[model samples]
Target: MSEAVDPGVAATSEPKEEKPCVQCLVPEIMTAWNSARGACEFVPDEKGREECRKELEEIAKDVKSIKKGSEVIYKAIKSSSNPAAFIQAQIEFAKTHNAANTEAILKWADEMEKAGKEIPEDIAKIVKFYRIQAGSQI
Candidate 1:
């Protein structure tokens, strides 16, 4: 007779579907930053710590890219044939980015202005509001 095995422990059982363990990317990224900071401050090996610092810098660059992408997408909505989805995505991105992302978005607007490109009124006004909110930081 074949040995009985529990169904829960069966290797042949279909794989359980994975669900979101992290609610959003923002919190997950923050966790990554905290982990990187810990590694930078507490890791004993110099090479490993340096690697962590590089990894942290790469994460920062990715965040900058995401900010720029959201800014461009939000501004580009004016020209889109179907803008509803893009607008919603932009709103979601803004919710995650908060005030800290304003400087970069404003800087992008400045370059567009300098290049003789018209800043879309909606984007222009948002950047202007942020610039005011940022005050001396801008």
Candidate 2:
């Protein structure tokens, strides 16, 4: 005899599908690509260098598939050889996507200053404008 089933529950043999966490995937890809980039830089032999390059290329393809319009920023950050360049990419991304996030822009500007990297004149002007606007809001 069949058992009585609760009306609120449905019996199913299929397992629930899990969705990918995009936020987690972005950092994982970035870390992997950055590690491959370093390996490419320090590999002594031509063969090793070629292998690392291949790995980096694969990671680049993954980056492309992750999202549109933002892959350039990811590549810039991943391929940057120095902190200054990385921070520059961050600032540019903030300007493009988080223009209203004045606190973040200011924080990056401060970090650039601390790092002794010259902030671009246009970016400096933007920071100044934002600072003035923020002051007026108080």
Tell me which residue pairs clash in candidate 1. none
Q: What is the alpha-carbon lDDT for the whole of candidate 1?
A: 0.55
Best by lDDT: 2
Decoy 1 TM-score against native: 0.29
TM-score of each: 0.29, 0.35
- Cα deviation of 23, candidate 2, in Å: 2.3
Q: 37-107, model 2: which lDDT tens digit per residue?
A: 64354445566556546646765776646643345445544554443544443455445445546789988
Q: Give the runs in model 2 whose Cα sits over 4 Å from its true position.
A: 3-10, 13-17, 62-138
Positional deviation of 13 in candidate 1, in angstroms? 42
Model 1, residue 6: displacement in angstroms?
50
Candidate 1 lDDT over residue span 1-138, tens digit each: 977887778756688785434445556556544433443433345664565456456555656343332333333344333355434544554554564467678779889978999988998788888878767444
